[model samples]
Target: MTVSVLICDDSNIARKQLKKALPEQWKESALLVNNGEEALEALQMGNFDLLFLDLTMPVMDGFQVLAAIKEQGIQVKTIVVSADLQIEARNKVAADGAIDFIRKPVSASALLDVLNTHGLL
Candidate 1:
């Protein structure tokens, strides 16, 4: 089965970097969103196997999006992809039901590791 991924980040550079890091095998199956609002909307409109979300954005933040997803009973898996490396922030996100945490400036190996651990690869 193809694993569909939704990438939500505010930075165009970060999005481009992540997109470049993703394995070519998954390129055709991923969707990119610029903010949490778009991510939530995309999740509502279609099914996704996983979400790579940023913590901060213009319209909505990752925490709010996550809460909304849980409130709405959406079943998609999520991972926080953020520059915030604070333990408290990580803990908060983990408490919110994220599947994993990936620090910003993500590497190809790191992306592969996350996918492998989630059994998406």
Candidate 2:
């Protein structure tokens, strides 16, 4: 089965790094967005299977995106990839339905482990 993927971050560098960290097959195909609003828009139309999101952004933030996903019952699996490592942020994302929270500058090994742990790969 094809696993559609989305990566959302305000920084161009972050987006490129995330794209690289994704499973090789998905790296070139994953959709990249600059913020939460764009992510949601793409998700609604793309029927994406996975989302790698950022917490701090100039446009809509990841928390708002997560809330909207829960409110609208969006079916995508979200994994928050951010520099926000506060315990509160972690707990909040979990309660909001994110399968996992990955710290920023995400390594390929960590991303792989999380995806593997959840059987996304």
User: Global lDDT of each model?
Assistant: 0.90, 0.91
Candidate 1 ranges beyond 4 A from true positions? none
- lDDT (10s digit) by residue, model 2, range 19-117: 888877887678999999999899777788999999999779999999999998999999999999999999999999999999999999999999999
Please report the TM-score between candidate 1 and the true structure: 0.95
Clashes of each: 0, 0
Question: Candidate 1 residues 49-112, lDDT tens each?
Answer: 8899999899999999999999999999999999999999899988888999998999999988
Candidate 2: give its CA RMSD in angstroms: 0.9
| Residue-level error in angstroms, candidate 1, position 90 | 0.7
